[model samples]
Target chain A: MTIQRRAAFGVAAALPFAGARGQAAQTIRIGVLNDQSGPYRDISGPSGVQCALQAVAEFGSRGFNVEVINADHQNRPDVGVNIARQWYDQGVDMIIDVPTSSVGLAVNNVAREKNKAYINTGSATSDLTGAQCSPNTIHWMYDTYMLAKSTGAAMVRAGGDTWFFITADYAFGHALERDTGNFVRGAGGRVLGSVRYPFPATTDFSSFLVQAQASRAKVIGFANAGADTINSIKQAAEFGVTRRGTKLAALLMFLPDVHSIGLETAQGLVLTESFYWDLNARTRAFTDRMRPRLRDVVPNMASAANYSATLHYLKAIADMGVAASKASGIDVINRMKAMPCDDDAFGAGTIRLDGRKLCPAYLFEVKAPAESRGRWDYYKLVQTTPAEEAFRPIGEGGCALVRS
Target chain B: MDLFGIPAPLLFGQVLLGLINGAFYALLSLGLAVIFGMLNVINFTHGAQFMMGAFVAWMLLEWLGIGYWGALLLAPLIVGATGIIMERLMIARLYKLDHLYGLLLTFGLGLIIEGLFRNEFGSSGLPYRIPVELQGAWDLDFMFMPVYRGWVVLVAFVMCLATWLVIEKTKIGSYLRAATENPALVQAFGINVPRMMTLTYGAGVALAAFAGVLAAPIYSVNPQMGSNLIIIVFAVVVIGGMGSILGSVLTGFGLGIIEGLTKVFYPEASSTVIFVVMALVLLARPAALLGRS
Candidate 1:
């Protein structure tokens, strides 16, 4: 027993020397934190972890070992913050795909304090880049501001001017309603009134739908997401609110939401997104690789963003060499900002001063049942907002990183 | 012209919607009261059974090509049978222990059922189309009332009434109530008290499943569907007195209408309106509205 103990101690003493000699073999740890079993699971759960693995595979690890770990934040801000702090302490270089905006902001603060990177793919609040912006955080995929700019402005331009909002009562929902309201007012549209429903609990939207119908708003904006968004739209159809000619504009929607609502009920609804699986050949290829891993469900914007942002993060690390790990989070983020982001899923894009991913936003109209050719063929692209104009301008964002 | 500073049409329309919500509350709360009354077990799996009812209905349509009418009949039987098996295998074992054990066991069962469904089908809700016959709406000049919603309220009222009649007037209900009062005496009277307990639990579960089928078209059919509605139903049960069948039925509908009215006037308090009422009722009479000492 004593000899065995000595041998174990001898092996442990040699491990450090071996690890020092093979420094290039260091593992790059990436943490994927988001809702794994809640309402947002289908949007960016295990599929998100798979997306990050695909990025590592596509990047070939660049002579360094890449490891990916994931945990379910369960949509709780405290759970998310605790996981993020523990991961940072355990040498996790970055965290990706946090969905809930409240959780996303909490994790962002932890990453900021720890000087680690946080690539936010699931959160929709523009506050991530606005009031809560951090050099260590990258606001990837879509945000409320871009969604409002694409869907809200486009709806007003199409003559549905008068508006009423059935908003989910939360940080993400309020931000979406506020941003969309701004666009409505900016487009010479009249603001009627709005109602805020309890988040996740209020399934029946009949009374709220009645209020919207009575107000006679040309567009009844559903400033909510996931199950809430689908429920509002379905209940609205049942109540005959949509049949009476009031358009239902979903400000924030994902591919999974469209699929769940089905094409028949969701037809003619206009929404804005940063990624669509059928957008182009490159997107199709990326989606093709991810579809089998995602159990037949197509990649939504959040899962797709996981692939794009991780690839770009790796590219930045590859450009910076071994010194990238020791450098502060800001230095690495600055390096990523300097580099042009070109991924198959999102195509060519760039990170702005406010850390918002600059990608062209597409306006998609849900196709009629007769127009759809196959499964997952939901969106028909209506218009493309340029990369520069799609997101909130850097100067306008209240990010401390941006000059006034 | 406005009524009390709000448009008259808006006020009436909201009241109508409130009545519809109340119908669901009544049906679910009635089921809870029935199960708790006989077995003295809270049957925390009520919500999961409700969710299963909708999923089973969807599966019936998807796999067996059964329509709404078929689902309305079949889902309750299937879910009720499952409830019988659960009671015999798991819940029956906890009868000798404290009542808290029964509650904990059923709560664990609810989690297992919800988790299994969520794993099989993702949390994103699947849409169930409104039946073809009940598709259109009635334009009452003040508001457009969907025919299907109207049918739901009418059917729920009739179901609650029928259930009340069965438990209060029938001979079998007399045996069941006698069993609740003294199981030993009911057994002495040649009644199979254990079997009666099993059937009573099954019947109560069937009631919840029936409501689930009715709700499939109105709400998105998802695993978490029953969970959200169950908490509100529990509050309704408490406010009405869990012991009184008619009391639960009344409280359920009353709170639903109050919640609907709150939405029109104070939208923010709509969700918590029932809880607020529950607290007020507790303060006024700790025994609940119709609860016995």
Candidate 2:
């Protein structure tokens, strides 16, 4: 096993520099915003732009011209809001694929304020569909609720009852832990304890791991994403926490993380996602087409969600005419929710009133090193969670539109 | 069952882990201290060089089939030679200028190097495994102490002692110190002062790379790995008294323990404990703990 982490992020073709401003309604500008240079970079980076462009390409230039642009949020809320405002002001009809839940929440507000559409594909916080959902926004892919249900509930059912969390002290981490812990408790499992470490720092997780191990919880849920998740998992083995028969649950692991953490280390890690590149022939065909544009990086669920969401958004635009779609971002979102959507990546799904996308979330276990397969063939599907059972019910989310 | 509501073994495990972390801090800060002391140049590129060491090791292992032992021996040499080139080509020109100039130049260089690596490797980072010889952990009841971490601490202490001995007790060490104090006097005494300074800078860079190599297995070999640890290492060097070699090593280990303890009690404050200590140190002794006023 070689450490050839071939970055799927193609040399950042920081293209479409502040695209031409004239004839605003004629062009449908889509801005793909997320952490392009920080820990979450590979999770969606320029590859998101590539995925968005795949939608534009498949949709073709018929009724309206679609343009995909991207920028780095640097994982900061302020930066994310600023870019969202700029894109909205400069005639970006919709913004998509923003990760970093804090940043995603920040941009969600800006999209609402500026009257532009936001389709969140990168962030994991279920609050986007829950208390904070906006009429102008749609929570495109997987959320914490689904992840918790698919993984935490499964672990509980499998007899790993007690839980402890090593959480990143942030909105995303907090929500993930909260959501997962709810499942563990609701399912008759008890949460022994949890440690909240400072985010974007705290590289050494040995102390936290020690604390978790001492709790002797049957399950140790990592309520963090990106590098924090990778670091915690890598060190978990080193400390022999996993060998002690304690189950490790990566609450928000992305597909890219499996390879980066190495299958040897990531082996047996159970995760939940709505989309996998090798799920079916259509997904494979989609990956094959999008691979060249992405410089051969495999499509993670979020990036693929960008394409799925974008295609659905474009189809809505075509169905309602570009003028009407451009008239109001909320109306566009409403049209999206009203219409059922289907694509090669996520298959068929419908956006709920609370903005949660309906799709079957799959439970997967990371393939061991000896599970001989090519690169990117990391997951083995364990169970399929149908749409209604996959995500939080629309009635539970206190979204004003949903309640009304 | 535990002291102060915490088990003795757990506390000891945390301390050991902290010390292991301190080994890295000592190795990294030791390099920064040497560079600032000898060359009077604030090497902001120190982190980039450290990252380069890890990357070079990964490259050697993946591409050249070099094992960890080979990387420990050769990664620093390769990264250090690049450091030599950097000093000769860019840093040598700013020796007489303001310190800010060197800092800015090195800072910019660090960004460029990090950017280049990020572009090529992407930010998620690659995994470099623990060498086979040191793969397993010793079941110490309280905590499973990984043999790799023990190895890291041992290697770091040896390297730090050897570096201190070379700089403080030897003839070349005296010559290097004299050149830092007064280059003109050293040059007049038939010693090539510029060559000595360049080599000193190279050695410091190598030390950083050494730490990077040591860290490769434990941390993911990513471009951002060095950047994350560098700021704290600088804080360690500052608290250790800029160029005070012994101070840097001592403070690095001390701060690591403190940080580790903070994680046990309040993880939210772990990253801040060092900065808090640095602030207190600055207020208490402007010249730092061990620096000569």
Candidate 3:
């Protein structure tokens, strides 16, 4: 009786692996791991999965059966690492669209170990392509370098020369503050001072704001994103720091952030994002396609990058044989890097040697309340940094892949 | 004059900022202390209820066009009624169980409520405009004090005082104190101790909701907002002498000031300062600063 019972349990355990083995070859599972309920949910969460699904539809999957699955990492590195390992081990070919930087770096390690593609769209840390760049990962969306150049450098050039930063105390915030400070000082602007507040908590930024104001900087650069960015901006207005002609530079503002801030408060704030739905006809067409899928949510750069990255990944799969692509993640990443990236969402762009996606970064000035048009129309384009200069120079990135 | 490398004016500004934050801590911990004193159960749902208060205020504005003034009154009442129902159906059953059971149930309930709100609104946090009457700033000698912030501190102090009075002075307050000490005796005396416990729970939840309404204008009215603040407030309650009314109020403000000063001296340790204090307080006095033996 014991032998029979043990045999039955053994068979039951092996059944799932057998089923997984049969489906692994013909299936392409893209796992969308992101901050589904944390601070980044608005910027990119459930909508990111929708963009991935939209990518599958637009690409048409060719011959393989494509499935998109998503899970919330809760913005923790351990949680993200576990999900990434589980997904990769269970036949997931790629994991895409993680917003939080710590989680992004953690999952980047997991993907390299498991030999699965990681097309990052949401994280802003430049370390993904610098010291921590993995052969399995592609840094797809806007990074700290692009944002600091577009918003930070642009503001400095426009005569907001002196800057103070209210930086979130985390990997993402530290990277942004560092990159922007470098650009600010590089552009002959003086760095007044900065306050690094605790992250994921410490919502009351009154003391930090007061400190920045007292620094008497020409511009207050907010080196944080999501709800932290929204709160600081809203509170800064309440403190009337903006009223005294100190320009507020939102170094990394997502579309949903401006949406949440409303026009009256968000007006006159300058920010940088790689994708805007209202930028051009192609972007508009892409938005129209995604509108029905996303359900009343405006598709921001994060969402657009998910769509662009997924489509390009699928296209690379179509170019290279499925067996070869599945056999090595590095090969697939190299193929993706080899191909010129063209999509309706981001237009024409190229994947650099350092695994960074090179695309034009737009400097957008938030329209004044009176100058606003309608809903979701928050930005008026100020200037555009071209695709070639939009990202960091490969030599300066300290990426081993690029250096060799 | 400068102390510890920070200028005096900035130090004064940080102190004032600390007081404003203390106002929130005082109000939140007062409710927590009251509930723990009467019910002997940890109120983990307080954070979710606070979040509900903010969401209700947003709903009243978006759905019914009610302004901030209207929401200040209605949000608490509505959330308090829900708390009463929650106490009756769920929390009341666990009165005879261990503290662990009460904690597990309420923590699970808090997660569910926060999840439901996140599902509906998403975690990006909705915007609530500052009230028109309290919009401008007062250029103080040290800093620019937003009128709304000052009003928040004033009203929070008054409300904390009022809550303290009702529980410490009145005949109803005496009955509440008596019921907590000897519920069976109080019930035998025709005091209806069970009803009082239920009402105390409701009132404590209402206090959290009131704080939420006050916070809606300043902070992000998102589901995670309460959870983020709740941990610190719990630390405040623990340091204040859990279940001690006056202790919770005083420690709430005191810790806020300490945390504020920490932000200036070493902002890296700002979030950790309260927890460190909590650990020290627990080690030195397990009963808490004002908690009875």
Candidate 4:
């Protein structure tokens, strides 16, 4: 019999082994750690945490054993690191849904050092699976290189020749601009001009828009997100920049952002995404099941990713028998890493030992008013970038774990 | 380092952009300072009031065909009127209590306002159109500055000065200051001190609303807008020592320009550099540059 089935039966029978180390415990303890309150709070928070709980129940029937503990890091690197370390100390085999990039990076290092599996479902930095890659840390969501390749290169090839950037003046924005610049150049496109707006600066994109207008770039790339993107796009409309035939490409966006910008401004804009709410049968099924429990708000990609990672972690722990030493975090994590995942979110995805999980990326275009779709029907699939082609090539990432 | 025979011009243009940002910081910090001074209370809700001003202006235009000119005139009045009601019902009860009570109350109010708006509009900002009159750029041989941006700096400066002049020079201002120092004595003088205090708060909030109206053209009007900007303003206020009215204004503009220069040079330290400067200033004077000892 599989260890998962044993753990399941042990938990159901109310045996002492369920809670005791090495004893047959039916329940598996999984940690859901992410920013609950901070700058990144709205991006992923209690909603994602709750999604893991829903996953625990869904996967529980398949000889699954589960318990979930949540913590809010407030976007502090140290806070996230501490939460992760303590969870491992308490025999947590896996941690899921870490959001903030800097914080997520910090947690990745600690997870590798401790040998506890870390599933980063929310962070956007490419360094995680590249130079800073770890055997235990898996960056499950989108990154700048993917965004650049999928949006910038694809758009240029499809006839967005001249390019200009209106970037948020910061590290993240700078990285995005650099990647997109390379993609534009590689596509034989002309680099027209660019402007850097101070972070959190009010929306006045007039000077920036005027600069882009003067450059006559066919596409004015906005290397910013959140309020910055909303303001730049809106002001671009006000200045008639879009009407002047300059398309705006938002490098990163979320469903909430689309709702705020509305159809008039967002229509015909092409962007890349790892997941969309209504993308496939699996995605629709997950959202439909989560809606009743979640009080009817559609499940976003972050929440879905959290559910998939948490369930897979539990299955792995049950597969590995509860020997006292085996109950130690590193031992359990190693066991999970050896398994293949087949779930609702990413059906048949694998969690590699080096922690670079694989998933397909989708290129989506914002729908126009004539589409006459309901709310949240904002995006129509343009193309699906296969999992292998969607990300930075493994050979080029230079990750130490790729060799081992 | 020179391009197009315009080294000085480039420096001058960057300086002008710095000054433009300074004007905004000055106006926002000035509003925070005024609200703190009159009520002996830190209004954490000031940012929400500012956001409310912009949203009110947008709703008026989008729903009622009020137009930009009309919103510029009416939005502040509408928001200030709401401020008066809030002050009477909620803030009035907190006087003679620890000042933190008012701060906490305002913070709660800020959350409620921001939450309600977030529920309706989400985190992204709704764009407001700049008036047609303010559309073009002014080419001055050195830099092409947007006309609306130039106007924002000009009007913000005038508004800050007018606020200082009214509070420091007028008869009503003297009564307000007197009440701040000794409300019991001022009330004994048959001045309706409570009413005066309430109006003082309303007016201070009105200034924030006015700044919001000006901001709607430049920034997206969003629920989180006020919360994001307010934290920095708090840091600005702390650095200014909230000492005197003029002190907050000057410190705000000075620090904004300093931040802008940081952007031109290092760029990475631009955001946290203000707080770093605040720490150094605190170490040197402990009471801020323009603050009282």
Listed per model, the TM-scores of chain A against the true chain A are 0.93, 0.94, 0.95, 0.85
Q: After superposition, how far is residue A44 of candidate 4 from its true place, in Å?
A: 2.4
Docking quality (DockQ) of candidate 1: 0.73
Question: Candidate 2: which pairs clash?
Answer: none
Task: Indicate the worst ten consecutive residues by lDDT in candidate 1 chain B.
Answer: B90-99
TM-score for each prediction?
0.96, 0.96, 0.96, 0.81
lDDT of 3 by residue, B1-293 (tens): 99888789899899999999999999998888899888998998889988899899999999999999999999999999999999999999999899888888888999999999988888888889999999999988678999999999999999989988998999999999998888989989988888999999999999999999999998888888889888988888888887998999999889989999998888878999999999999999998899887
Candidate 4's C-alpha runs over 4 A off are A1-24, A159-178, A188-220, A235-247, A314-344, A351-353, A370-372, B1-20, B52-170, B213-223, B234-266, B272-293
Query: Candidate 1 — which pairs collide?
Result: none
lDDT per residue (tens digit) for residues A1-404 in model 4: 11222243343334343456443344456667775543344455666877788878776554545566677776678888877776665556577888756778888888777776677888766777888887666677577788888999878988998899988876567778988898899889987877777675444455566557666689999998767777777667655677657788899877666666777767888887777778889888877888876664566667777877777766766576544323455565556567877777777776555556677778889899789378678889998787777777787777887777
Candidate 2 Cα errors over 4 Å, as ranges: A1-23
Q: Residues B1-293, candidate 4, lDDT per residue (tens digit)?
A: 45544265555565676677678778888888887877888989989988998899989987999988898789888988899999999999998899889899999999998778766554556657678899876666555667887888889999989999998999998998888889899999999998987887888788888888888876767877787678778778888887378888887788777876655555545667888988898899887777767
Interface RMSD of each: 1.0, 0.8, 0.9, 4.6
Range of the 10 consecutive residues with the lowest summed lDDT in candidate 2 chain B: B1-10
Global lDDT of model 3: 0.89
Clashing pairs in 3: none
